[model samples]
Target: MWAAGNVSDVLAAVPQSAGAGNTAGGAINMDLILEDARRATEAREAASATPFDGTMEAEVSRRVLGTRAHGLEGPA
Candidate 1:
């Protein structure tokens, strides 16, 4: 876990925890993006014959956005 603040006293505490939280979240998101890109590349190569209907992108966007909108707080 990432934490930033004074360990000894309350008055001495410099609030950097929120920045730490953002860094941690950004790291996780970058990792997910890299993994998804790799998988997408592999899938694209393997799916040469698959026809693309423009709606597929919209459908996928909707599903992912919906999941985010609802807050995926629990495990799948």
Candidate 2:
């Protein structure tokens, strides 16, 4: 039951998990579980710095992938 979706439960009232704190159930440790969310947030922040906009993607395709990507070339 302790999951990322449990934030509403955590905020609505004192989290039972906070008191549990890796000692009682051993099923979910909030500190360890939240690390994944932290990592994902960091990855998102890093990606935001240099997003894949279409203009750059097209240039890379033209320069690197070349006309091979244009399957119509064989027909035309």
Candidate 3:
């Protein structure tokens, strides 16, 4: 999972059932997963925007200070 600007991303892999007939019939589709991720991201962004102040200065500062205290880069 990842969050950027006004979007979040999610990628998941579902396995095929072995009892469905074939044991090696599992498949992976990036396009479908990407679309789902985009939708979910948009939904989250919309929800967040409803109450956001349109600025993340405080949050960014807190993260930076915390990182400095820990002697490491800010949380990613």
Q: lDDT of all the models against the reference?
A: 0.63, 0.60, 0.49
lDDT of candidate 1 over 1-76, digit per residue (tens): 4343343333443456555556667887898999999999899878754446677766776677764544554444
Stretches of candidate 3 off by over 4 Å are 1-27, 50-55, 67-76
Q: Which one is best on TM-score?
A: 1
What would you estimate as the lDDT of candidate 3? Answer: 0.49
Question: How many steric clashes between backbone atoms does each model show?
Answer: 0, 0, 0
Q: Rank the candidates by TM-score, best first.
A: 1, 3, 2
lDDT of 3 by residue, 1-76 (tens): 3222212212322332222213222222455678899999889888754434546655665666865544556656
lDDT of 2 by residue, 1-76 (tens): 5543235355533455455543433555566678889998889878744458887678877787565666444222
The parts of candidate 2 lying over 4 Å away from their true place are 1-28, 49-76
Worst 10 residues of 3 by lDDT: 4-13
Q: Which residue runs of candidate 1 sit more than 4 Å off their true CA positions?
A: 1-14, 49-76
* Each prediction's TM-score versus the true structure: 0.44, 0.29, 0.31
